[model samples]
Target: MTGTRFDPSWFEAHHVNLSATERRAATLTTRRTVKKDWQAAWLAQAITCIDLTTLAGDDTPSRVQRLCAKARQPLRDDIMAALGLDALRVGAVCVYPTMVAHAVKALEGSGVPVASVATGFPAGLMPLSLRLAEINYAVDQGASEVDIVITREYALTGQWSKLYDEIAAMREACGPAHMKAILATGDLQTLGNVYKASMVAMQAGSDFIKTSTGKEGLNATLPVSLTMVRALRDFREKSGQIVGFKPAGGIKSAKDAIAWLILMKEELGTRWTRNDLFRFGASSMLGDIERQLEHHVTGRYSAANRHAMA
Candidate 1:
C-alpha cells in the first residue's frame, strides 16, 4: 500500500495524553482473557503473525537455514495435530541485508517471505545514497519485504519534510518489496513524537509503521504501540489505505503474544490480527509459544530448552 504525500497537518496538531494513554494501555491485558481451546486458538494465530527473526552478530548461513526451517514449520507436527491444525507457518523470516539470499534460498516454495533490514539498520545514520543502495541490494537478492530504519535525528529535530523525503526515497528504492519503517519509538522521547513519526512514515509510503528495531533501550510497550495504531487508524480513515503494525522488541512470551493480539483486535478490528496487517518481530517468542501449546496439549510444562530457536 502506497502512502500519501507528506502532510504535516495530518499529525502536527495531534496531541497524545500521556495519562490517558497509559491508563488505556494498562487495561489491555486485564480487560480481556482467553483460555482453554480459545486460548490455544489465539496462540496458533499469533504464531502465524510472527516474523521469525535472527539478527545477532554471530549469525551464519546454517543458522539462518535453521531459522527458515522453523519459520516453515513453527509448531511440532504432533502439537499441531493435537490442535487440529493441518499447517502452520510464520508470517516471514527477517534477517540482515547480507543474509537475505541465504534465507530466501532456504525458505524457497514455503510461502514465507524473506524480510531484510536495510537503510543502516538499528542506527540509519549512513548517507542517504548508501542507505538506498542497501535496500536495492536486498531486493536484488530476492527479499520480498524490506525493513528500513528511519533516521531518528530527523524526527528528533522536527524536520518532518527531510524525514518524509528520506523515507519516500527509501520506499521508492524498495520497488516491489513491501517496506516496514521502524520508528525506534524508545528513542523518540514522547508519545506525540511517536505519533508524528508514524504519520510521516505512512505519508512517505511505508507499508508498515513498526515500533522498534529490537535494538532500542525501550521496546514495544502498550502505550507506545497504542499511539502508533491510533495514528494508523487515523491515516486509514483519511487516505483509505490500510497500513500494518509491528511491535519488535522485548516481546518474548506466549502471554505477551496474546496481549498484543488483543490490542490489535480491540483497536483495529479483527482484520488487523492477521499476519498481513500485524506481526511480532521476535526470535525467542516462538519457543515460549510452542512450550505453552505443548503444555496445553500434554498438560505438562516442558523445559524451555526443549523448544530452541535458531
Candidate 2:
C-alpha cells in the first residue's frame, strides 16, 4: 500500500541537473516571507509536524518517557491559550528500536504515533535477514511507523536493483506500520544519486523517503531536499501516488523550519505541508520554535533555557 511495484526503467530514466537545482534551492529562502502573527501561525504548524525525538547514545527509559511527555504537550499551557489552541501535539515520537515499547507505553491514550528507527539505523550495514527481522520486531512491539535505513553501499555501488529489493523486503516486514526509508544522502555523494535513491525507494514501497539519519557529518541540506522533493513530484506524476518526505538532522531553528515549509509549498503545493506528508525529525527544533512563538505573542524573547525540549 505504501509504494508501487518496482520498475527498473523508471529509476534508470531519471536525471537531475546540479546547477539548476542549486539555483532553485538558493531562491527558496528569499522568495517568501512571513511576519508577526503569520510567522507565529507557521511555527505552530511546524510544531505539529515535528517527530519529537530523542536518540542519544546515553538515552534511558526515563529520558524516552520525558520526551514522550513533551510530544504530547509540546507547547506550554500559557502559550497554547494565547494562541487560541485548545489541544496541540506533535506528529509523532521517534526513538531507537530498543525504546519503541517505552515510547508507545509513554504515549498511551495519546493519539501520537510512536516511530522507531530500525534496520541498523545511522549505518544500515547489517545483513538483510537481520534488518527485516528488526522491522518485524518493532512492529510487533506496537510501533505505528518504522523508519528504516537503506543500505548506503547499494547506492554507492550503483546497485539500484539490490537497493530496491532490500527496501521492498523491509516494507513487507513492516506489515501494517508505515515504513520511512532513510537514504542517508550525505554518503550518496551527489544530487544525482539522491534523486536515483529516492526514486528507487519510492518504487520499493517506501511510505516516506527521509533525507538523513542525523549521524552523517553533513546531513539534510536545502539543495538535497529540493532534489528529493522534485523526485517526489516526478514520482507522483508517473505513478499517480503520493509519497511523504522527511528532512532530519541539523534543522534546529524556527527559521530553518520556515524555509523547509516554503520549499514544500512552492514545489509540491500546500498539500505536502501537513503532518501526514511532511515531518521534521528533530529534537531541539521544538524548543526554538516555542521560543519564537512566545516572542510573537508576548513581544519579548525567552531564554533558550526556558524552552526545554524534554
Task: Give the winner by TM-score.
Answer: 1
In order of appearance, the predictions have TM-scores of 0.99, 0.98
| Cα-lDDT of candidate 1 | 0.94
Note the residue pairs that clash in candidate 2: none
Off by over 4 Å in 2: none
Model 1, range 100-135, lDDT digits (tens) per residue?
A: 999999999999999999998989989999999999
Model 1: colliding residue pairs: none
* lDDT: worst 10-residue window of model 2: 1-10
The local lDDT score (0 to 100) that residue 147 gets in candidate 2 is 96
Query: Cα RMSD for candidate 2?
Result: 0.9
lDDT of each: 0.94, 0.92
- Candidate 1, 216: how far from true, in Å? 1.1
